[model samples]
Target: MTNTNFLISGKLIDIVSREIIKAELEIKEGQIVSIRKKESVPDRYILPGLVDAHMHIESSLLIPSRFANLAVQQGTLGVVTDPHEIANVLGEIGVDFMINDAKKVPIEIRFGVPSCVPATKHETSGFVLDSNIVESLLKREEVVCLAEVMDFVGVVEEDLEVLRKIRACKNLGKKVDGHAPGLKGQNLKKYVASGISADHECSNIEEALEKISLGMMIQIREGSAAKDFEALYPLFDSHPEKIMLCTDDLHPDDLIENGHINYLIKRGLKKGLDLFSLLRAATYNPIQHYGLDLGMLQLGDPADFIVIDHPESFVVEQAYRKGKCIYKDRKVLFETNNDIILNNFSRKSILLSDLQVKPQNGSLHAIVVKDGDLLTDSLLCEPKIDNGNVVSDVENDLLKIVVMSRYDNGKPVMGFAKGFGFKKGAIAESIAHDSHNIIAVGTSDEDLLHAINTLIDMKGGIVAVNNGDREAVRLEVAGLMSNKTGEDLISDYTRLRKFASGLGSSFESPFMTLAFMSLLVIPKLKLSDKGLFDVEQFKVINLFKDL
Candidate 1:
């Protein structure tokens, strides 16, 4: 239990005034009542709790409440999240689940209206939140902004439906986020002109600078796979106010092993960036931009602040939300309930024949993946024929990749991919990006069949199958997150990842890379449940080159 009235003293670091001074704070009824200057105080430092500018809570593989249980320990008292992943699976019900579950914790979680429900026309999702639905969601008190508008092409080409969604947000005085990677010049201007004010997809400082010049906020991202912080960290010095920190799609292992926004702050400090600038980017900028009700340790504001050991070490010793102690001494002070379970999976087991692909007359287009990048490349390679059917060329690092609709028993769409470095087994997950379908990659049809079936039997989760062994972590909530405790989820996910690595994958996060295989919104080449998509051309294309 928390006392309604209390007093604390510390070296308060004022981000707005850019100063640190010894002070005593008087708190009452979850609000800061007054601040008094002190001659001497404790050695600890007090600062506003961190805030994630933009992220997908589902990407952590834990439900909103469980995510809060871990994030509060890292001093994250507020988050501006986009429920786009689960929205693709269960639509409005998914959004409501996130909102209700978030209320069970002390963190302030504000959701956005998912702008792209199906993500793209070249894919299949369980439900669609059209313009009307988006407008309705925008009216909700908990909905603060419109999520990332992934279809940049539609905005650039003046698509009516896309414009309607943007207009709805604007009419309701809400901001619209962007997802245009490598988009520049007139196309970027048009995208910005359409009311998409911020983008977290800039890969380099040059791109970020151009976007900033157009009055667009750049969210420097360093998530599980798509790491852009190193390339954009210079923004701290160049355009501090125009920048914010985000981890667009963080996984459980990364969340547990490293940290959240705090990790970025530590990295920035190591790079010799200004501490106040980094803090402003992580806290004040996001809170102001999204109109979040989280406190900034100011008078009459909610008593949302954290106690750190010192500026050099920057270890959070205590985290308080609304005058309530939520975390202290390296332990979370709150417990989460695990009774809720929601999912939308209808996929069934598949046979070896379902994974077969007939040989084509020409070379095939294979999706090329990198170690820690979301953008994929296209490769043209000769298909290795076996029994008159195309087969994986394990020697050349070429493997079979498939995307199947988990909403129904549709015929699987098969394509070839390179760069997973898997030599023996197969890995599958229902956490595929945007559409959240079942995506698998393997060196053999039998292993791929087994891996995918394992996920089907479990309803939804990530699985690795090799020879006769299998390991998995179930995500029973909307096929995107689990109701498990953060520690349990992290342990299970780590073990599952190690088991996948034992199967010969060398990538740091192979399952995360596999999830994006079906993200047709990204560049170069990608696969969808509908078929292999040519993103640059913005259409589904034949896997085989024209004869």
Candidate 2:
């Protein structure tokens, strides 16, 4: 190596050795050429670039290129993203879309083959990534590990296809991520025994400890939908080496306001954690576990690192990928190009009468939404009925929720939800969890009709209908992402959220909360396009059935 293409001076953080020194670095041909100790350094601290151990870029509602731009300024040089959200809509093409889109940027995007398409048998999605698809994806160099296995039931039972997917990854010498929330004892033991290497869904510290004890890495997730940092932060003190940090489903607003992994580091430091422990979570752990090509700031390693003012805030001043300055002065330097490509969506006219159903009894299963929590409760409540049909009780803040198939014309599944707090109007989103159906919750049938119809007219997107006012953001690609600029996407999302708020809804993140409505794997009760689902029993039941 010659002298240097660029020279960086800072208090260098050595994540592998758990030490910091005032040093100067020499970069040549996108690789760190030399490291020299210096008596004085710039007013900055340099560390290995952070990686989101697991994330779904589609959840950001921006395409791969835009999401990368948002992440790089926050010091995320790479992400291990599962395109499972889009894969459910377009199958193999969806995964390929993510890979191809990622290639037009400087950030590292390691896509994982979605292990469970349709998520479960009780749901209807546009495509299914069966065992064959999983094997084919494993052969792609861009495909890293098997995405989070949401089907804990299949893995625990040693389901042949699920096991086969794991085998495919193992044969390729790749890691397998997990998503078993609230799993314990023999079930957890068996699931890990199948070679699932990591999990991002532990709700409690005990669950985190148990999984770690069984030789599995625990990814403490802090994202828009699920925030598990409070419960799992203790693990950093106990088992720092086995821990990784990730924002599995972050929203664009959160990404712009707070940083990415740097946000976690600030939160961890504020909570009085050891600096090195938090650093390892952000730098070394995920890269080592997934065998990422991202660097550890060593000589001859790829010069992927960030310059921060200090450890207390971990505010990224600049970020470099492969020795090229990508983010500087709080702005990401990436070319912007957004292209709209339609995948699968079915536009079917729906009427309010089509969603009407009479409860066999007075009590109905209502999904109780907890603020800032993904876990929901099934509440058996007496609903107000009109004629022979049960209706939304806005007085109690209970609203009717509908899940309609966006892939095909099907009878919309109806259920109820609690804590939405909207007295008059409806909010709809096409990016429903797992199955990605069009889901809407409304106080009135008229409003529900408008919301669902708006999404259908837009092909696939999110819309809010309040009284007569309406707002929407079209997600043309797989009905889960927008090709719009970041500013426009943020503006549209904010407008729709404001419209929902104007209707008296009292949720922190309404759109994301609505999106998770059909995630049957979470728990309690949920509605899918097929029918009302009892996640606890793993069975579809009639809403009119007596509990």
Candidate 3:
């Protein structure tokens, strides 16, 4: 229920003043009109609703409206969302879809102009958002900043186009987020000097501290795949003001099971970090940095706040936005409208011959994936030859990985990947990072073809095929997000994950991990629709070692 004028009583957490006081707030017309100190109040705590510093809504496999429905229940009233995933597939049309869909819900969905559409030249994206298009996007009232500049090499090498995009954001007085993982010393200095303000890709304390020292805000990322909070939590005590909390890419199951920023706050409290500091990181820090128009429980601000059981428990009981109770009684009060579906999938089914790799004389250069980390390692292993072709070796845990172009009927690019631990099935998804192409990894050629064909038939979705069983979830929106409600998507995705796990793959989020396998920007090695990309070298290398 929403009332223009209402009174709420609780122990208000004054984040700015760093104190808690029993007070009764007089909310008039969706603004905190008055705050009167009370002698006693209900046994609940009122604080500013949480904000996700950085995240990709597409990664959750739900559209912005559906994502907000789940996020608001977790006390997340706002999210700094980067629409680059969709931008790569559908360009500006995809971004407009996100902004328009977000309007159907009350949650604040701040968008950023994707700085890297294709991410790198080693991959093929359906469309490119060049500097001209980027400047046009930055002019939008809804776009607050330029998304992560994954092309760090361009900035360091003084690429004119890359610098042009940065200048556009700077000239507009907007923020330019960075994405230089493992960069340090002179290169880092040069990249930061190019006007990059914040980074959420730091996986270690030293990298985060060095960037923080250079006036770059660090976002401690704890997502479905890459987790860095444990390594960077010390910043909460040392540089609380300079750090914020974010989940760069959270899967549907993770969002449903673990909660959102509220989960991070609960974890921080258990770590014995200062309550105010943790609260500030999730609330005040990102708001100030992003210049969000959210209330901090102050008079004359928007009436956006959450009611919690207590600080120690950190369990959000209710969430209110603009004086409206959006979440209460373990349910989202508002309904999501996401019936429209937009997609850009044009790939066709592949034959088993398309998956064949002629036996080479040298060892294979395989991508070695690490569980819970985006950074991958490169390994040269002996190929298992079968019927005059190099094949998947299940005993060695090395599987055949393929990246097929979704933009056209192009031949699939084949490579080898370790760490999925798939004994007998194939998982294919059109949710590959950046490009949103069809990527699959399997232990057998038949299963791999089956999984990829299923996604092709669905236009776009995730599929896990083993024996005669097939589990799938269709992502009808840009082949990156689903139009289904959060609950439906979660149920379907959970079952697909369980089916993939039953195939003998043991990764916590195999589909999410698989999605990143084609992202050329992240690190060491990756696969693209073109070929196997060596990210460290910034080039596509031959799969056969010493070829």
Candidate 4:
């Protein structure tokens, strides 16, 4: 009765028993029909396909179809994406766009309906995904769980509205995700008590262990901006069952240069952890936790699996979905999207004076940028007054940073930032987090003005202006994504990075690091369109330290 049949002989990884047996896998009609023992040890390892426990496909700067093409090359057969970034920009329509586009490819993009739309009321974003909206999304076929409940304070304080959304998911028997960065002790206990099961924000192993002890899955994330793998990789051996790998936000260059979940697998293998545990974290663990349908090569299971070379390198030789070859030998067989631009933007240029921060006789509250880390330090610097304005001190490396409200019609708010390492020129991105307003950092008002205006002129994109030369990369879709192939996004974004590097930036994923500067959550200090935000204090502090 089998219409199509194939024999895959290899050392099949037994995900449940954590053992490998020489076997010949028999697959037919998109299902693993049987697995029979063999006497010979094969040259490769056959196991379930890789999975990314958490990610924002938009952060890759490519649409679902294009993103899938790149992801499968790294053997990432599935992704647990939040879609919160684009959802914040375009609401339900945005979530629908990602889903419909994903249907064009084979990669199973399991999306969590965004739990928080605007994230917070502190800044302006395009739309709101309230409890009513979430309830509606939960009923959809693609919605698996509630996206991260970033409002940890709301859960701890038991705020009515935030609790309402969590309860709605729980009522429907869906999982609730967590985003409690640096959360510990009783507060951590209180958060878990509210039914949130996983967290990707633990920056250290101790914090990761503590959360795991309290029954929370710790997603070890190493992405373009926030790198937490070093701090949490020990969990691969310590608490293998409680940890998962994720790229919270990955740029196209990282995907091309480093890799996806496979990147962590290699790092963990080099550290000499058990192969069974490493492979489970990369594949089986997420499947079980998310209740995903991705296979384990079991009979009657959907034939979504991979054949990889042995543990020494663990290079995926072939990846299959529905028993069809989607990737082979580092090349994806899938077709990605072509250039299809779409955005919601209106060009509103600003004058250089609008970017000025006048001096005051007080310590300046500046955002201290850390390379490859999302968490920033609230630094105190003395204001440098020049020509009746508290201008950027390029000599001291304290430059001006601004967040212009793009959604609800607002002007730019100016503040100071340290550690951007820019000596001249300015950089701007429409990819600012949450509200996603245009955020820029420059050594002077003139440079900052030019960079920001370039994005405004493009309606939504990243731009760098150094001296007289300018380079811009447009993300026309909701100003958060591009409808181009991954190759083109990588090529275009690379040029922008090269342009910024020509000025003075030495930061890896510079534009990615720039976008997080305005993210009000996960911070000590950050800039939002409202003003200079003191995150720990949870209030908008003045740019100058003194009144």
RMSD per model, one decimal: 1.1, 1.8, 1.1, 1.8
- Tens-place lDDT digits, model 3, residues 47-125: 9999999999999889999999888878899899999999999999999988988888988889889999889877789
201, model 3: CA deviation in Å?
0.6
Q: List model 1 lDDT by residue over 229-307, tens digit each.
A: 8999999998999999999999978887788999999999999999999999999999999999889988898999999
Worst 10 residues of 3 by lDDT: 337-346
**Which residue window of length 10 is worst by lDDT in model 1?**
310-319
The lDDT of each candidate is 0.92, 0.87, 0.91, 0.85
What are the per-residue Cα lDDT tens digits for candidate 4 across 138-168? 8777777898999988899999889999998
Colliding pairs, model 3: none
- What is the TM-score of candidate 4? 0.97
